[model samples]
Target: MDPAGGCPHAVNARLRTRGAVAPVVLPGEVEGAVVLGHEALKDFLAHPDVAKDPRHFTALHEGRIAEGWPLRTFATVRGMTTADGADHRRLRSLVSRAFTTRRVAELRPDVEALTDRLLDGLEGAAAAGRGVADLRRHFAMPLPMGVIGELLGVDAEYRDRLHHLSSRVVATDLGPEEVLAANRELPALLGTIAAAKAAHPGDDLIGALIAAREEDGDRLAPEELIGTLVLMIVAGHETTLNLITNAVRALCAHRDQLALVRDGRAGWADVVEETLRWDAPVSYFPFRYPVRDLTVGGAVVRRGTPVLAGYSAAGRDPAAHGPDADRFDVTRSARPEAARHLSLGHGAHYCLGAPLARLEATVALERLFARFPELDIAVPEHALAPHAGFVGNSVRDLPVRLHP
Candidate 1:
């Protein structure tokens, strides 16, 4: 697949015709394989021979991947995202305790309050003759940012800078120096936050992680602490931001489906699921290396070759979702046998923040529509550009009218 700057979904749709696992050109003209079939990608995710650690990646370990490679920032992280087996379990275990369902439940009030505040801000802007608002900037972006920031004990003062640095980490269009700069700045910022939390601990996730020590004298190392926080903030913030943005965009485009939600024919949960299946928030995730040479979808992937899990492509795979997979239907998930979308991920590395993301999106969408049922896109759908980089899927901005 060529790296054209148009809609990634369209490119992926053509790739699907090639087979389940298709070769593609990533940014920086890098060669990689993307798993396009739904079942094929699922197997790729949970396969024992597949791995997340960069050490197993041949190109990265052999110095073929340069320090300034656009995607190098992602593959080289020391976080739980790059850990394997026991180490992965240990790191995930430490943080999993903090992201408990009850904890997510407790955050609902904060999410609701934040959602209301953002909607109020949007209403004020619309009434002030602004005529339109970038929901992505004013609403979709901040809701999760505020929630994760609150959860991590990060001050509001640091939220904007943290997000800017985090955006650079996923941007494939950035130059080597820019990528390198962000690579340095993000962890440094997280470290500063970690150090400050160390000086004054609070009942937040970062504080808990700082104070956590396992029974066998295991504790998060210095780098692991920063890496874990980066993962929590970046992954936690970006994925949900796109999910909310994509859901709103899809509902606007398919008002008939939105009408289903309005008439009580479908719930907001269905809207969330349909948007996930039709236009997943994460287009493709990088750098899953095969420990041994493996065959996927009739393609032989060499051992140690980097494989990308095409979550967005697989979500709409015709083989898995049938011929009408591309169609966005709010009632699809209501079927007892409907397939679950992997937008949040699967297997041992499934997103720890899934519950929180779902909660935020559901609450955000429900409250957003309730507050402004006449909400509509301010610009043509075709005019909206995709988010930079392949890792996070979303429009650059969601311009919408709070009134007519």
Candidate 2:
């Protein structure tokens, strides 16, 4: 996938002609590899020989991915994202138990309360100023951070630092050194917290993860324990922040769709789902190394080759959806499982935090529009610049007018 996840014109058109799996030369850490179509992506992910984290990178597998920072801090620990087979199952089970569907459902009131508080502040700021505020900072950013922070039992004070660090880790606009610095800070803080939790486990998810045990009385490795906690925070909030921001931008930019939701022709769920297809929060999944020579979409991805999961590519794929796939239409029939494909990922590596992300975005967006029905973007659509990142799909700031 191109670094510019939202700029889908020529990249999409060119790739569409190359069939389901196209040879692509992506810059930065990614080099030439195959890009999967919607179906191909699902197939690639679920393939028996495919590994979630790239094993081709020797340093990464040992949790020592080279960086300006020390190897101790990289998120390459063999946790859920990187593990395979039994290791993957064990890690996923522990982490998933901490974020059960029951727990996600229990978060509704807290998400609602957090959304309301953020909106109150935004409304006041808009009232005081010229009715303009960077909704990205004031609303989109804080709501998910707040919700995930509380859920993970991170202290309120660490939220700001975590957000700043996560921005560095995910944003492509930043230089390598800056990104490395962000990645460095997180594991240090999280390690200290996890050590404390291991000693005096609390009632929160982090504590639950810290105390989790396997049938033979096995415990999570020190690296996995900390990695799982940090993964939850970054993954939980980062995607949800972008989801809410993208949804608001889509609705405001396409007023006809906004009106459809307002007129009850579609609901918030429709808006969320459509935006997910139109502008996925996670544009590209990181390196997935094939365990052996594998044929994907007729291309032979050699064993140990770095395969990028072109999630954004799959989102608007015409074959999966329809001839009108490129167009973002709220009223289109919900793309069945096989068609829309793996925006939230699929199979064993499916995002455990997805249900919670959806809940937060739903509450945040509904409360936002319900409170300020006439909300409008303060800047021209063209002026809303996105960050220079290969994977993340959020913009810099979503400036909007409350009284507009």
Candidate 3:
């Protein structure tokens, strides 16, 4: 695949060779940057020289590069995604207070309860002789959103609107105007929530962020607060949904692996990790630009290059996971940290909601299979639809026969 061919974000895992740093084209680049993956992935993700935050781009401010095509579509705001170094540390530190070890532990009972409740609904649908249920919508979709909403202090009335914005923003198929319109509404909604939280503090993540103070007595600016909340809501809701959705599909697709877990031979943790490794939740997230010119993986990535991580393909790097890297095997042992999946990302930008996502997926998958017991895929393998965009690794729906 020519790096100069299309939107680098749309570069599918199937088209690019694993662990190979190929020169790929971004929308505006005359000469595209080297796309890093496979053997080059671990180092590149951990490299301190490369910055993830787009706000610090030297080329953008200096007008060295044209910012029309990709820049217009994605108006990245100032938040953790746009922060680096001290700013990142401070913002992440404040946010970390909301996801404390004790807080996460406290969430277990609620998560388990939510899982059982959703499963009960599924069981009820099966008992009523409906036979078929859209587990993607019924089970995988709602659980994470509900949990994250409660955690963030977002009201129930706002959930439907949030879902729509998330879908639109991640979609690669949306036209320019449609993309702008979606981006426009997202912050307005988050701002409304932020304002309410400010007026009436609640015992929730948003409130925690608002009240959190740094060692130097700094607070998250108003816009930063909204950006933080938006990040938490989107990542907390969507990625976890995909994680559960992908896991269910993977287990159903590989019945032998399902039997191992359902019959008690293997643990649910094995299924979650294996699924994260095999089918990543978010395929390719965003571009991380080089602060300056740097050579990576036998190629020169010039200064200000917009380089996105090939996250979905990194997990299957043959150098790390052996020749069977692409195969789904629940019994596989955990790989070394360096060679592990970049599904949830790596380094400072590594996903903060990872623990919650894992907990949600595990609890949901466990209760789901246990309650239904004989749940079977109602649709053909090809009938299931992958997410339309390159951003998320998800199916349109997972139709199942609960009583089968």
Best by TM-score: 1
Better-scoring candidate (TM-score), 1 or 3: 1
- Per-residue CA lDDT of model 3 for 216-235, tens digit only, reads 78877888898887787778
Query: Which residue runs of candidate 3 sit more than 4 Å off their true CA positions?
Result: 1-15, 26-36, 56-75, 123-129, 334-339
Task: Summing lDDT over every window of 10 consecutive residues in candidate 3, give the lowest-scoring window.
Answer: 1-10
Cand. 1 Cα-lDDT? 0.87
Error of 1 at 25 (Å): 2.4
Error of 2 at 163 (Å): 0.9
For 1-404, candidate 1 gives per-residue lDDT tens digits of 33324477888978878899988877766678999888888888999999999898888887888788878967988888999999999899988975789989988888899999998898877777477888998898899999999988999999999989988887787788988899999999999989999999998889999998878998889988988988988987888899999999988888898899989999998888888888888888887999998999889998988888898898888777878898999998877878888877889999998889889999999999998888999999889987887777888888899887
- Backbone atom clashes (below 3 Å) for every candidate: 0, 1, 4
How are the candidates ranked when ordered by TM-score, highest leading? 1, 2, 3
Q: Report the poorest 10 consecutive residues by lDDT, candidate 1.
A: 1-10
Q: Using lDDT as the measure, which candidate wins?
A: 1
lDDT per model vs. reference: 0.87, 0.75, 0.74
Model 2 Cα lDDT, one tens digit per residue, 89-119: 9888886764678988888888899899999
**Which regions of candidate 2 deviate over 4 angstroms?**
1-10, 26-34, 56-75, 334-338
- Model 3: how far residue 375 lies from native, Å: 1.4
